[model samples]
Target: MQLSLPFTTLLAGVLLALNVNAVPVAQQPRMVTLPLKRMEVRSDEHPRILLQQQINRASKRLALMTGREAPTEAMMTEALRKRVLEVEGPEGLERRRVGLFGATKDKRFNRTGVPKNGKRSPKKGKNAGNAGNAGATGNTGATGNGGAAAGSSAIGGPDSATGVEVANTPTTGNSLGLNIEGPDVGYLATIQMGTPPQNYLILMDSGSADLWVASEACQSTAGGDCGNHQTLGSTSSSSFVASNTPFQVTYGTGAVQGAIIQDDITVAGLTLKAHTFGVTTSETPDFADDSVPFDGLMGLAQSTLSEQQTPTPVESLASAGLISDAITSYKISRAADNLNDGEITFGALDTTKFDQSTLTTVPNVNTQGFWEAALDAITVDGQDTGLQGRTAILDTGTTLIVAPVDDATAVHQLITGSQADGQGGFTVPCDFNQSVALTVGGTVFAIEPQDIALQPPNQDGSCTSGISGGSFGTSNTEWLVGDVFLKNAYYSTDVGKNTVSLAKLV
Candidate 1:
């Protein structure tokens, strides 16, 4: 099946190819295909949860296509079943049928291995690609645009190395951050994008799926306030623009609105390619009140969350075939004092640079291709916390570790105990000596001393301003382990590995 890329992605590809015309076409937007494992098929087990979500999404598309309201989940499932039949005919979708997204009967996945449809998934399966997305014919997930790939293959590997085991491929010329720098995870992005906050350093997040900058256009009922984004036309920034894409980002906690623009968005020495950044034109004043500087935000979510959310710049680069592959993996650190400018490398993780072990990996769901892993348990020091190890979503996009509230409370209590703490969040003695360890992929990872000090429990010094309860909790059971846990580890989301690899930081 052929993949149909979004028009925006195609346009970006064309612009990039044209702007940097020095390279060869074959080399431009390069692509690589990695071998995938073929897993055994089963009938009794239920279809993977993600597949079910897709089925539901497809049903909505079907309803829209036919000019009708959306159907119930059951009805949607039935509709998809019927639609597959309509496309495949009375003989039924055969095992030989290829899915639009490079998914084949023989291809296996990390978490989503062996379809409920089994070997027949790709064989006339509905997943081959979306009939509408793959041009009008609906190639589904097939990469269009003369060989654009799904997710990060155009980069060094599947960002899935961050999540589940997936077939990660890479495009050419892009270096797989094989040795990317580890960034501090604790820094916060001052929401104030304009006006008061002028040159505040904000956290360049690659984890949480949405991109937002505090702006005056917020709809917070409490009041309108802008936090720390540089006000447009601010002198601190050498250059800034309002792209007119009026950006409004809705987070689990707040929202921001402004225009998208092409500006010089820089952090630490890494200057992002000239791209669409957000700025507040009309908004609530909460962002301005934050006292940070900047114009807007840069989205790092996967390409999937662009709709109804901040556009993921990272995924856009991948889809447009700009940077090689989606970033294979990322390293983060929580630092002392100021949050330093971290690094963001395209392609592979520089394994040679890190003093670590084998790279376990996982597949990344496109909505936001993040470094994801399954958590077997959270071990504090040498002890097993007995927390049920469910799949842990390692998101640079999010700020806090959102486990089941109860789980979070338990972990928080264990770390804080009856220490003399005020309100800055979790705190231990100034000279806490024990190491907090988290185990994944059968590996035990110990959190560094600084990382463990999450935050001092007081309104006191820099070291004291600490990590609060949950960074941001959602109304779900799935635990979102944010950068706090990721800082001490060298993580790679190798789609090819079908597993999330964890390595101890040197």
Candidate 2:
């Protein structure tokens, strides 16, 4: 969407020039942005929550895989937690370490109680035999706080309890909260054939794109743990074609073991000729976490980021020239519950669907994956308060606005007016009130009043709450502008156009 000329000032505008100093440079607003929006799927990179789920599911299959009496669930769970801590330690928290890039209990890192003085020592006291000097641990494999030693492969994902090297990536997430696995690639086709025909609610997560739902073959300790999603394998309308090859995935946080399956997958008016996907048979609660609607998930993110070795169904269709160019858009109308029932468009924004606006361009940090853009500044009552602070990461995954530690604190102070909430965040006295606005790209739009008062009440009647917008994540050094922020504006990412359009939500 076009920012009103009024929204953009000359100095803030993105300026481009050509041909000598002959012509004066034209100025436009520059949106401070992230390169992650650039396309390139780190599908192998799994979120912590998903990792926990995989670990949990893997615990269930450990007995079958190892052919022994598996230890109870809780034991495996604690072990995984400790393992991850050993590798990441607490320092990695600064980067808000999560996924593969951060500390995984699975890998190793550089750290120790004390360094060996500079000269090496010999195992046999030097005079005993001839050889390189060594400390007790033999080769002091580089120093890493997390994961396995530098040279060893960290089993596709992090270790759950203690960062140690293992020969192969664990096919089981048996210890995680939501653990399960089915053969990779082989599981994809089965789920497609299993899901019954009909509309279903689905989580549209960009990370590790693979679309599948729990089948009757699936098991969960949480009693029928699937979301508002339907089971494809259970439906007669459901079709299943099992591939001989198993489906396996190695995520930064965890892994998914399943099989590949291909079947008809449709969203809105869009339908695929033959979509390849996964059917997770492992037991885990991820699919059935809550009443969140959806028969399964839909991976519209780029293929490059896909967790699978095979091409993404969305990207495959886009390449074959099936849809309008792999452009997926959503209009969440919290107005009348459309917030939950919002539509997912495959090709482009259905202009006839809702209020449409001109698109703005954000240079892609990574051109082929999840689209991201620059956010110029964040304001409190129109003040350039958050500008000198951290930038905002506008993401579809998050639900609300999350300011940095400083910014989030200021917002809490302004809204709640409580000294107790100074360094920490507190909710406004339920009766207290104020406007919360964010300056994204160049436009300043205020967050809704209802959204501002986000915290629930406590026993003493003091309404302490989370940082105003979304959860305050210290790991990430930037502010998070999620859907709550997006709802105030019309947004679009045109990979072909190299443009991301934003307009007032109205």
The most accurate candidate by TM-score is 2
Candidate 1: residue 462 lDDT (0-100) = 23
In the range 1-506, model 1's lDDT, one tens digit per residue, is: 00111110000000000000011123323331111101111212112221222223322322222224433434533433343444345444343234312333222211122222311111111122221211211111223223322332332222121110111122232211111111222222211122222222233333334444433243323344443232344342334454545545543212355665554432211234444555554543222322111223344435344432434544544555654555544444333422221223334554533465645444443223444566667765566667774556565433334444355455555564424222112345555556666666676676666655534223332232122332122333345555556666776553333345566655
lDDT tens per residue, model 2, 103-215:
23221111110111222222111111111111001111212112232333332222221111121211111000000111000001001122333323234443335566545
**Model 2, TM vs. native:** 0.52
Per-residue lDDT value at 276 in model 1: 52
Quantify all predictions' global Cα lDDT against the true fold: 0.35, 0.35
Total clashing pairs in model 1:
106
Which regions in candidate 2 have their CA more than 4 angstroms from the true location? 1-200, 206-208, 221-229, 233-239, 244-256, 289-293, 310-314, 335-341, 352-359, 366-368, 413-425, 431-433, 455-476, 495-499
